[model samples]
Target chain A: MKAAVIGIGLIGGSMALALKEKGLIEKAIGVDNNVTHTTKALELGLVDDINSLEQAVQESDLVILAVPVHAISGLLPRVLDLVDRQVVMDVGSTKAAMLEVIASHPKRSRFVASHPMWGTEYSGPEAAVKDAFAGRATVICNREESDKDAVTLVEDLYTTLGMHLVYMDAAAHDVHVAYVSHISHITSFALANTVLEKEREEDAIFELASAGFASTVRLAKSNPETWASIFMENRENVLDVLNEHISQLRKFKACLEKENIEYLAELMANANKIKRILK
Target chain B: MKAAVIGIGLIGGSMALALKEKGLIEKAIGVDNNVTHTTKALELGLVDDINSLEQAVQESDLVILAVPVHAISGLLPRVLDLVDRQVVMDVGSTKAAMLEVIASHPKRSRFVASHPMWGTEYSGPEAAVKDAFAGRATVICNREESDKDAVTLVEDLYTTLGMHLVYMDAAAHDVHVAYVSHISHITSFALANTVLEKEREEDAIFELASAGFASTVRLAKSNPETWASIFMENRENVLDVLNEHISQLRKFKACLEKENIEYLAELMANANKIKRILK
Candidate 1:
């Protein structure tokens, strides 16, 4: 298969690498608006060649939209208009907005909405890594909207790459991602800001950061263009989760103020159930 | 040298394992209020034998108090009363309260207040693992209050375990830990509660939890008894950071509500500074 990956940053670049590594694609071509990313993706051997979106859609059997959430909403319909038998998919973090934008498109049947639930704090072509999508869950939104052949092609490709595929509606996917994914980024960013605001001593933060702190704050280092788009696209659900999160923190603070050890302990023990669920 | 680890749970059991693994102690003994812990520690080979607090103080050359913050605040001075040239230390999370509790004790010179900036979500004797302290920082608070001999012995032990030792005042230590450590736990626990409350679909969460969510929420799985005490003891500092964190989230929410892409992008870009510090 000849695959064309658009916006070849971290997710797209990594997906390109994974496809080539598994010999699933005969040739993987890269497409990006940024000249630096285009050059880096080529230099890093993430793609066999750099191609324009027009040319890539004409020649490739598979075309992937792996750009920021807002970019995906704007670009997917344009790509869908041009592709005939070529299978189109997006690896965006937010699905409902993007799906709604393309729902009325003529070639919507060729487009599959997918979110491979895996990412790191880094970005750009240079941040692309091999074996990036293994053993992670990928959520497929609005599967009923895509043609069976297109959906099966995307599913088989992800399965071949060792990802667990699950199905959900675009609206439900947005709500769940807000809870499981979007809020995490918000908390991490706020955490980094909190520490940076309060602790002026840089050396102390560097010296005292344990693995727990590092892991919890890792998403704080995510790309601004990407996350800001995600936060805006899923604004209502994000706000809902954010309000609940703040309320929970306030409860915790009140418990601590009252020295209510028993209640605080119960809260932590309840949260500890996440380990079993996560594992 | 002989080492006695009081309250042989996660921190104490891990310390005992490190001491034995590094061949720094000839024999390591366990002391805990719970008989089950003592038995489990022995069964797990974290200690050579179980000993009483008095027996541990009488026989061991180095005694480490690895109990909760509340217990450490009350127990440190009493343990110091029995000090007969034996260097004693603690691995509590809060330093200000513990240091204040033993500030005027005559045997303060024999006690060292150290907090190893390392831990996992798991707890109890079963959580003990070899090399837990490697490549982590250990902060020694109120160093001036400790005798020269006691400081030297405690520093040497941490150094032998491949840890970097940092010196800071008790108040400063509490503030930094609140910013770097305690607040992370609070955010994580609150995040878990937020998701649990908002997203009622348990199976969806189980299916959609990505590596990013797992990393950000890992601290939520921490032991209740241990964290409740730390939060209560460090309530003021924790509350201060928590308030700042809530304010930060509110700012992000408002920016999203207004679709202020510029401000949202700038906020995320500023948070990206954590990459430079964390890496």
Candidate 2:
């Protein structure tokens, strides 16, 4: 099968690599608005050639939309309008908005909404890595709305690449991602800002940073364009989670201020249950 | 040299292993209030034998305190009172509180206040592992207050174990740690709680959790007893950082709610500076 990956940045570039690695695609063509990304993707051997979106849709059997969330909502319907028997999928972070945009499209059956839960605090074509989606969960939304062939082809491709596929409604997917993934980025960014704001002397922070702090604040380094779009698209759910997170922190502070060790211990023990889910 | 590790749990057990690995101590002894820990430390070969605090003080040339912050403050001076010429040091998280507790002691010169910038979420003797302190920073606080011989011996031991020794004032050490280390745990614990509270169905969280969430929330699995004490001991600094952290989150939330894309983008871009510090 021939595949065309749009956006050709971290997610798209990495997906292109995975598809080629699994030998599922005979040729993977890249599509990006940024000339630098397209050139870098080709130079890095992430794709066989760079193709325009119009040409890519015309020639490829499968087309992937792996751009930022806002772009995906606008671009999916246009791609779906042009493709006949081709299976088109998006690897976006937010799903509900995009699903809404293409809900009534004539060729919506050819479009599959997928979110492979794998990424790093880096972006662009240079950030693409091999085997990026292996052993990670990929959420497929509105599967029943898509044509069986499109769903099967996308699922088989992801399965071939060693990803665990799960199904959820687009609305539900947005809520879950807000809880499990989106809130982390917000917390990390805030944590970084908190430290940077308080510790004005950069040398002290650099010298004394521990592994725990590094791990916890790692996501603060994620690309801004991608995250800004994600935060905006999933604004309501993200805001709800953010409010709860701040409330939890306030409770923790209040308990500490009162020197209520027993309550603090109980709260921590409850939080410790996260270990079971994480493992 | 003979060494005794008081409170033989995570930090002490790991320290004993490091000392044994470097051949810096001929025989290492363990002292803990819990009998299970004592037996487990001996069984795991973290120490050669289990010894009482009095026996350890009488026989060992160096004594290391690896207990919680409050315990260190209460126990260090008592241990110093019995020491003749032996060196005493601690690997606690907070420095100012512990330093202040032992400030006016006649034996203060014999004690070295140190904090190793390494830890895992797990605790107890079972959590100890070899090479724990290697390739990590060890902060020695108020070193000028320590006797020359005691400082030399403690610094030499950490150096021999392949750690970088950094000197800082006790107050500054406490403030930096609160920003870099303690706040990470607070954010992680609150994050875990936020997810658990918002996502009533555990199955969604279990299925959708990505590597990002796992890494960001990993520290939430830490032992409560250990963390509660640290938070309480460093209460003022922790609260200060927590206030700033909550304010940052509120700003992010307001930006998202108002769809203020420009501000959100700039905030994330600023947070992205953490990459340089971490790298």
Candidate 3:
């Protein structure tokens, strides 16, 4: 099957590379508004060819929306209008808004909403890497709403990429991602801003940043355009989690202010419980 | 040189392994209040022998205090009292408090204030690994206060372990770590708490937690005793940076609440500057 990937940046480029590497598609067609990205995607061999959106959609059996969430919200409806029998899927971070926008569309059953739970802090076509989605989870949101053929193809795509599948509704997917993904970016971004704002000694930070600091703040380097769109699209859930995060931070502040060493230990011990889940 | 590593946990056990592997020490003597640790350290071949603190100090040419920050603050003075010709040092997280307690000790010149900027989330003797400190920075605070020969010996020790040395005053080191290290732990612990408190679905978190979430929250699994002592000892500096971090996060919350997409993008762009320092 031929697959057309829109907005050929990190996710799109990697998806194209994976599908091609696994021989899941006969040809990978690229579509990106950024001429630079399209050129880089071609140079990097992430896509077999570049084509116009209309042409790519018309020629391919599969259409993958791999744009930022904001762009997906605006682009999905138009893509659906252009779709006939081709199965459509999106690899966007936020699912609720994307699914909500096309809830009433005539071709709603043609689209599968998915979030493959893998990414690097880096972006753009240059950041595309082979085997990027292996051994990770891919959330298939509102799978029952989509046509069986559409959902099956998307599942096969992720499975071929070596990902395990989890099914949930779009709203639930949004809320879960707010906790697991969106809040992480906010904390990392805020952490970088905090150090950049108050530390002032860039050389010291460069020399002294241990693996701990590097790991915690690495996501701060994520594409601003991509993350801003994600946070905004999932505004309510993101805000709710952000507020909880701030309050959680406040508890540490209070413990420090009161010199409540026991309470502080308790808080950290509670956090240690995450070991059971993560490790 | 013969070396005695007190505590015999993560930092101490790792130090023993590196010094032995590099042949920096002719023999490594382990001293720990916990017998299980001493037994484990010996079994892991991290040390040649286990001895009482007094016996170890008397026999070894160098002593390393690698206990919790609170323990180090009290233990440093006593360890200094035992020093005759031996050079003493610490690998604790906080510096100012540890240095202050022994500011007027008779053997003050014999003690080197040092922090090896490396660690993993796990702890104890089993956590020890060879060649752990390579390619990391080891801070030597208030080098001038240490005797010339003592400083040289400590510096050579870290160098043999494949670590580059950075020098700063104890106060500056404490403040810098508050920004780079301490606050990262706080954020991680708090983030873990936030998710645990709000997200009742542990399965969702376990399934959906991606590399981003894992990197940001991995430090949450750090030892509670180790971190609580570090935070309490460096309370003021930690509080200052924690306040700054909270304010930075508030900017993101504000942007989301106000639907200020441009400002949100601007904030993330600023955070992306960390890429320059970290990468």
Candidate 4:
């Protein structure tokens, strides 16, 4: 099948690579607004060729949107307006904004809202990895709203790519991501700022950093443009999680200030419960 | 050289395994106050045998303290009192508090205060892994206070174990670690708590958790006993960093609350500068 992957950055590029690797995508055309990204995606062999969005959408059997939430929301209606029978899915982080924007589109069933629940700190075509979404959850929101044929085709392709599909409403999907994915980026970025502001000497962070610190702060290196668009699109949910996170930090701070070892141990044990869910 | 590894837990046991793997320690005798850890240490081949603290200290050419900070600080002086020519090193997280505890010991020159800048969330002898310390920093604090021969022994052994040795004063080491290491644990635990409280359903966390969330909150699963001891031992430094960290979080929250995309992007861009230090 021919596929058109929009954005052609990390997620889109990776999707192309993974599909082509499995021979599912006989011809994958890249569609990116950034000339550099389009050139890099082709140079990295992330796609078979580059094409205009109009040309790619008209010709491909599948159109995958992997741009930032704002861009996806802006382009979804236009893409849906052009597609005849092709299935369109987005791998953006936030779902509610884009899903709501295209809720009343005339050809809504041809569009599927999907988040692959996978990413890395780096971005652009250079950051794409083969089999990036394998063994990770891919949430398909508002599946009941889409046509059965379109949903089945998307699910089958994801299954072939080694993903476990979890179906949820767009609202629920946004809330879950805000709790898990979006908040992590904020915490990591904030943590990186905390260390950078206090630890003036760069050599010290380089010399003293361990596996724990690196893992915790790794997300801080994410592309600001992409994340800023996400935080803006999903402002309320992200704010809600950030409020809870700040309160949690305050609780830890108070325990440390009072030297309440018992309370501190209890708090850490409570946090350890995350292992039950994470591992 | 023969080495007696005290505590026989994660850090100590891993040290024993690395030393044995490199043939740096011909005989590794494990000394642990906890019976289960001692048994596990021997069963896992983390050490050649188990022994009492007195016998181990007396028999070995080197005594490596790999216990919680509280235990290390409490036991350092007594161990030093018993040592004749054995080079003693404590691989505890905090340096200043423990260094001050045994500052005036007649045998202070025989003791080297070291903190291996590496660990996993899990603990106990079962958590020990071969080559755990390789490619990580091993900070030797107040090295000038330790005898030349003792300091050289540790530096050489750590070098052989594939570790880079960084030298600093005890106070400086404590402060730096509070920023780079201790605060990360607090942030991760707080983040875990935030998610646990908000996402009541365990399945949602599992279904939606991306690599970003898992990596950022991984430290939350750390052993409470080990972390509580470090926070208490480095109370002042930890409190200092915690205050700065909370302030940074508050800044992020205010920016998000205001829906100030420009400000949030700028903050994340600033944080991205951490790539310079971390990589």
Top model number, lDDT:
3
Native interface contact recovery, all models: 0.84, 0.90, 0.92, 0.92
Compared with the true structure, what per-residue lDDT tens digits does model 3 show for residues A1-279? 999999999999999999989999989999999999999999999998999999999999999999999999899999999999999999999988878889999999999999999999999999999989999999999988999989989999899899999999989999999999999999999999999998788999988999999999999999999999999999999999999999999999999999999999999999999998999
Indicate which candidate wins on DockQ.
3
Preferred candidate (DockQ higher): 1 or 2:
2
lDDT of 1 by residue, A20-71 (tens): 8888998988989899999988999998899899998898999999889888
Extract clashing residue pairs from model 4.
none
Order of the predicted models by DockQ, top scorer first: 3, 2, 4, 1
TM-score of 1: 0.98
User: Model 3 segments beyond 4 Å from truth?
Assistant: none
Q: Identify the superior model by DockQ, candidate 2 or candidate 4.
A: 2
In order of lDDT, best first, we have 3, 2, 4, 1
Error of 4 at B163 (Å): 1.2
lDDT of 4 at B137: 90
Which lDDT value does model 3 have at B209? 97
Chain B TM-score, candidate 2?
0.98
Clash totals, every prediction = 0, 0, 0, 0
Return whichever of 1 and 3 wins on lDDT. 3
